[model samples]
Target: MECIVRPAQSADCDHLMGMIREIAEYHNLLDEVKINSQVLSADGFGGDPFYQCLVAELAPEQEGKQGQGIGKKLMSEVAKLALARGCVEMKFTVAEWNVRALAWYRQLGAQDKTEAGGWHCVELGGEALQRLAGDRR
Candidate 1:
């Protein structure tokens, strides 16, 4: 079996958007999706790029196989990119109830930061963000 982990391009926006919706559906949050493929393409490949991401594409014929490892491969590539970009740490949130994701990340030496280092994952979005900023519009 073979796989590829590569930098995302504008052409991949649609596929990535599909995956995002799929994941959102898996989490029962499909209604929260507000962005589309165009937004993803511009933000990712625009003049003032906001972020970087990697894409993993597995061999189409590799089915009924054990240990696909597509995600680990993608993360390894992203880790390299982060290091090259002078980042100290990589961060992303996973739903605590997603046992498979939790186990996979733990296997890669990730820890619950709150437990290990007394760090917390905090977020403020939408109304909370505007309220905190004292913006009424």
Candidate 2:
């Protein structure tokens, strides 16, 4: 399968969301998903785009193959995207127990801050996020 990693367009909302759900399901966190395609398209393609995305998929003739370096290609493209966006560093959080994903990341020369530098991953979302934003006034 010749996998092509490419920048995602607004038309890819459904497929991209499906891939997101797939990953969420893989991590046993499907119930945590709340965003829909409209939000995805807006956040990804709105007046003020929040982020960029890349998609990796098997070629049309090879739709069902896994572990075919597609993900790595996608990540590689993401690295390029980050660089093009003038980012100096790239980072993503992985669950502590997701050893497979951790290994894959390591293979890409990504350092695990938790294991290597004793850093902690933190988040402030939901009501906390709103409260913090509201405190600005």
* lDDT values for all models: 0.84, 0.86
Error of 2 at 25 (Å): 1.7
1-137 per-residue lDDT for model 2 (tens digits):
77777778999999888988999998899999999999999999989999878777566776755587777777778888789989988898999898988989899999999888889998999999999989966
Query: What is the Å distance of residue 76 in model 2 from its true position?
Result: 1.4
Evaluate residue 32 in candidate 1 and report its C-alpha lDDT on the 0 to 100 scale: 98
* Model 2 stretches astray by more than 4 angstroms: none
Q: Best by TM-score, which number?
A: 2
Q: Runs in model 1 with CA error above 4 Å?
A: 60-66, 134-137
Q: How much lDDT does candidate 2 score?
A: 0.86
lDDT of 1 by residue, 61-132 (tens): 765233677777888988888899899887778887988887888889888786679887898999999888
